[model samples]
Target: MGSTHAPVDLSSEYAADFRAHQRTLRLGAMTVWPSTVQPLLSRRTAKLVRCSDPGTYNLTLVLEGTARASWDDREAEYRPYDLHSQNSWQPCTVQVGQNDQIVRCVGVEIPRNLVALPRNSADRAIGRPLSAREGVGALLAGFLTRLIADTSAYRATDGPRLGAVLGDLVSALFAHTLDSGRELSPEAHRRTLTLSVRSFIGRNLHDPDLTPSTVAAAHNVSTSYLYRLFQDENVTIGALIRRERLERARRDLADPAQHGVPVHEIAARWGFTHHSAFTRAFRAAHGTSPSDYRQARHQPTSIPERASGGTPTGSADQVM
Candidate 1:
């Protein structure tokens, strides 16, 4: 991730955050980088990288602002926390808004063979903006954010095994994002089932009746299959539902436009019908009541880093 200085007209902070995600890799070559730049229309650069190493699937999480990605028949706009995939072997371009604005993104380059997904499925996912807030996308995004934020925690001894697990998850996420009904080998079916469940749950989060039974019934899977699918998640469907709701609520509460909206109303909007219950849950998850969290966010400066909706400090990766 090379650093390019911005035009003199723009704020110099443009390139400052560019350096955050470019930290050196301690985990083999899984370098994490947080970057804010325009589509690098540089064939020579892409070619040089291709010559040096195996082609990769570049996965990105837009940490702040928005960016547009285009490749083949697939072209899409991605926003903050949205995940998207691109193949390093092909020519692609991604650009952000003008007016000196910068779009922050966190990216990781996965060697193509390490992804474990079929070529067709990965192609379908390319340039598609996957929902990072839910499903396999959620699980993968969260893990990536943690890993990038704390790369030092990972020892060289953990490399091969963790890399395999990472590949498996990335495969599931790509398959889930595309939802392309390509027949898979027997080995893929088990991972496919869990991905389907998570996607179904994410789509139906607004339905207060989105219980495990309803989820299983909708997917034509028995409750037992649903249970087996999520065993690796270490969280129940109910817990996931609540966590997703609270995350959405946290983003809304931090938004200035939503300041006029009542805290209880915001909770109900995300499927929490009971005010007291929502408050309790919010406090339990955030270590403070929803009202207080919102109040703190609006107090002018010194807003909590999470409330800012920007890339976290000391982010380890950036996308070109």
Candidate 2:
């Protein structure tokens, strides 16, 4: 990818090797760029080559620090944890701050065909900010962030599977931004809900009150409906929540920094209420009590979490 850039200050031609790491799955790709001061990447009309690969809708997620983007008659500001989508075919400029502010992000590109939205509807959404504060947006953000942070935890077999999930997430997110004006297919609708439920669960992991009923209420769905949705996955919503909570607690216990935090406190931090109940659950889940698990130098690992996807919306493939 021979991409070129110019400094925002117009002081001179931009020249800097910014520290950016990128990874590509079968259907989606993620690129992480550490914060930098200058050399903003610019893709103008002269650069969106017609002979390149099909264009995609790329979502730039600002994990840390603030940044900005510009494209076809539009400009958008992004801060930490903000997901901003743009058309890969459209020319754009992405700029970040200087001073080693440490801006890091994972970009997910969604193929246009996979998005299932009208061209105009899709166009209307470019470069707009999608906050990871609540709803499906938060869920997708968490999934993408986790995927980038723990890519090694995923096996080759999980690629296509995650891609499909990523597509569903993108559809849901697009629909969300479109409000009720947009229509999602039956399958996309169900999947969107499932991902929403999953996202809800993830966001509220610390809340002991995060139950199926509460989650259903948040999404305006019945508890039974929510249960049915996750039923076939062989993972009850309760089980998923418990699994996530336990996993989080287990990791916290394993951390030497958390050593001073008591076992009961740690359990409660992840939603466990009763000390005995928490201890029992911890022991049952990890084959040892939280206290012992924390004290032990190397605790036996448990099951890893699953993943999700997005698509390519960048690179005309030439930028020397």
Candidate 3:
């Protein structure tokens, strides 16, 4: 959640202790060492040490020379673009070669509450190692990259908005990692359904028969479920359709080309079957008749210009 950068010196004197110290850092934070040069002697000795707290969970992506991590009684070799994670407060040892290495990594400390899912669910979703090779991994990597790059622009005033963005990104990442598809969480599924329903409604705005049932059928969901999903948003499916149609008509009437088109034709084009109904609704929403509004918009320019004579006389049009 917070980040800072400092130069690190990994020499023989402090290398072992540093490794031991890293193993105890909190799980919720991660460190990224961009690039550093290693002395030849350290490479030959392979005296690199890395460790993390027992309750901490972290992910590391190696971008350079060979490196290995020891955890869970097993050692895993890391290659460029390779992702690795750990669950529980356990020690992890990482060995890197002497050649200059560059690595860009993100470490996440999973919260305690999140660690308490059903045994099998936890193991599959959170407790075990998760790879960032696809889907949510890709999204998280991109989001973190942008977050780190734009940290300065995200101020206290922008906390809620930024927090929402982060929360969505985390939800998406976890959902993909769990492989629960659309069945994982009700909120996640609702978000997806809402997006789909909105898209369907927008595309079918010109269809006069586009109703809640039709939209639900198009997405293979029941009309009741569709209504339930949008309940919290405080708008009904029927209202959305009417609003979209009126919006389209309002836009067309304001356009110069549609100036020559009849108001009723514009209404019909956007799926309004009855002109009188459309006019009444439009007036209620906009506080003006469509024709009057359109004419007012086309009022002439107020600037005046001088009239020109056929030719300029030598005496400047004087009576001389």
Candidate 4:
């Protein structure tokens, strides 16, 4: 590629048979690319930077294989699940893949100004491999993987919102990596914390013990602060937990493979240990009892379909 903003020289021992694949998603100002490439070496020279520098930063999360990157006299090797950053203005070299193995990675590109961190701190992070296996890095890595796996969950209008979320996660991860968490803007901190809390909730939805107090304690936040976070989103923490649980149970009820699974079992699977309580909650949300909802979905095709189509009748309120 020869564009000044994104120029690089590529070489490879398998040049004649080199292959690469990438699926890119552009959300507002940020772009994500999940890619797989054969063993190769790429270099960005000073002359290329002088031609034009877009003042962008690239964050790459290695999903497979081994690679090395160097910039500003610093060099580091990255293995699977590790992350590294690159500055567009810096001259750099990246050697990716090894022993005929293909390198798989997810790359995120955003304008430098979008990252809420000191320029020097951000620069210092370049070429240093960051661990994506835990902490904020783990959250960012999981978000990136899920975003790529199902971009369809979001609508076109969600581009800017999704981009902003990505930026917040990146900034939080970088700040944590630099031990500058206190430097994050108040808004960014709140957003990142909220995201972390939500992720924790999703992972523990099957635990009936999951609650606002437990969630707050798990994240080292006060219950009041956690309530404030959900208040900002116009939802109660308790309600969000119940909603997620009900949704999971509803999904299981509607799945044909789960037909043999009893309604009470489905309810228990999603944290609803009380059959009566589960029935009332499911009815309130879906407008049908669990047993009825399951039967309706499993009805013969010859049955006259309601306006809700395959969805159970009275559950038209459900989001498509």
Candidate 5:
């Protein structure tokens, strides 16, 4: 599916009559824009938001300006390209700068079941403004941009998959924010630990020796608890390791620089040791043999044939 609506001109269309012109568009179960306006937001005074009904969570991305956002008596200035999420039910104010600013944001109403934290949790999480500068924030920004760009593909049938992506992104962002500040609680600690473990696993994908015992020891947690941590994520330790390793191999194979590297070496670099075993795994994962993949990447027209007797593997992609 794709968007049929023309690009919106919020500045001219809703510049005046702020109350009636506030636009809200539903994108799947989530709402994309709720009462968004460029003019109603300014730097001179704090803008108080009155939701039609209590919303779950308000996700905002700073498209082209800087401003300070305040929730539950805490505040922080957000610069261009920064992303922030807030609990909409709580009374909050956003202060913009003197220059006209443009912001593109999407707010997702937090589901009832996930909001079962103690009363202070929301306050603690939103009280101090959170910035999406790294980790989950970086992933969330990319995911949300992709989501909004391809709304049709993220329909009812794809809800579960999309929801999982959203959950992981948000979990990572909030967990990072809470841990960096002094306000993290016991529950927050657990959530942050889970995200950290996942991130560590991702960064160590090339290490063939990465294992449950290694991960558990790195985090100073027992093997049983590490398994338990991933239970809620619908995956196991072994599953994550495999997924990361395969993903890395796929990326390296696709790189033009690797046109000469032997498939066996590529596999070994990412943990696979045996030539036959790596070929089988690559075929199963990518539906193509490693030699075929290399040949396809180095088609005669795309890559010049080596002069004399130089092996293709002697080029950039090969192991020295």
Candidate 6:
């Protein structure tokens, strides 16, 4: 809302019944906000923009219902999975939801200077709907969704690094749209490519034939170039693949629902062709064999009693 961009004036015919839920995750200077809300019309007038311009850009991906945004004589309508952006320095209006329907979306806010695009070029993208169904946009959408879904998995120290990755992905998507991909800084390109390659590896971890060469080919980069991409990461491409596969297998083994499944079957499910090798790697990484790890994870412990119980105190005016 206004916390990321300029404050807006909001109204709705369904005002009496309006309600909203929003969860915010701070990623260093960037913020990820996932919200579900009733229908409303919001406007950021020139006066508001002048009074409070954080010099940031707000990118929104609609996950449900619909919305329309307009600024500088430009207007665009967005449906589920579609992306649209608004600049804090601009005056804009957004009408979300319809016929009392609820709207859901994830929004990202980053400093304008971090985008690695000229101010004018970036402004041209405001209020323009970008497709999040494929390419870098899809990758970004998935990254944001995962971040919001499991904020607890990341430590506070990971925020700035995560924000940099998001910024690189956003810059790449915008550059691709403007046919200026070549203009991105070398670091931005490298970071974006690294993220893309990691995402690809994650999706294909179940393929036993997956290797560094195959991964490079899939991304249209040479094997040597792929190695160079991960130079700063301190882990080779093959090691990264192996580590990810082992991590996935470890998670499955620990799931109580899969406890009845054989350890070898769990290993094979994550592309481990040899049970012995899987066992060795799992132990090296976790200090325990897969079976032992699963046993320890599934062990039950007595629950602690709550010191006190009462209704949670919070304001009903928690509007998104």
Query: Which candidate number maximizes TM-score?
Result: 4
Give the range of the ten consecutive residues with the poorest summed lDDT in model 5.
1-10
Looking at model 2, the pairs that clash are: 2-319, 2-320, 3-319, 56-313, 109-311, 109-312, 110-311, 166-309
* Residue range 178-258, candidate 3, lDDT tens digits: 755453456545564565577667778989999999999987799998888889989999998999989988889988877
Cα lDDT listed for each candidate? 0.66, 0.68, 0.55, 0.85, 0.57, 0.85
* Model 6 Cα lDDT, one tens digit per residue, 213-247: 99999988899999989998899999999999999
lDDT of each residue in 39-155, candidate 4, tens digit only: 999899898888878899999999999999887778889999899788888899999988899999999999989988887887767766589998889899999998877664465
Check candidate 6 and list the clashing pairs: none
How would you encode candidate 5's per-residue C-alpha lDDT over 1-320 as one tens digit per residue? 01111111122334554332223334334444422335333211122233132446556766555667665446677775576556645555565433444444544545423433443554455644555555657666656565555343333445544554455455545655566323334454566567667777877766778899999998889999999888978999988887777778777877888767777788888877677877887788778887786677667575465677532322111111
RMSD list, candidates in order: 9.5, 7.0, 16.8, 5.2, 11.4, 5.2
User: Which has the better lDDT: candidate 4, or candidate 5?
Assistant: 4
What are the models' TM-scores? 0.53, 0.72, 0.44, 0.89, 0.59, 0.82
lDDT of 5 at 201: 83
Ranking by lDDT: 4, 6, 2, 1, 5, 3
Preferred candidate (lDDT higher): 1 or 5:
1
- Shift in Å, residue 61, candidate 6: 1.6
Candidate 6 runs further than 4 Å off: 1-5, 150-158, 276-280, 283-320
How high is the lDDT of residue 309 in model 2?
Answer: 63
Overall local distance difference test of candidate 5: 0.57
TM-score of 4: 0.89
What stretches of model 4 exceed 4 Å from their correct place? 152-155, 300-320
- The TM-score of predicted model 3 comes to 0.44
Candidate 1 lDDT for residue 37: 61
Model 2 Cα lDDT, one tens digit per residue, 240-269: 999999999988887777778878888888
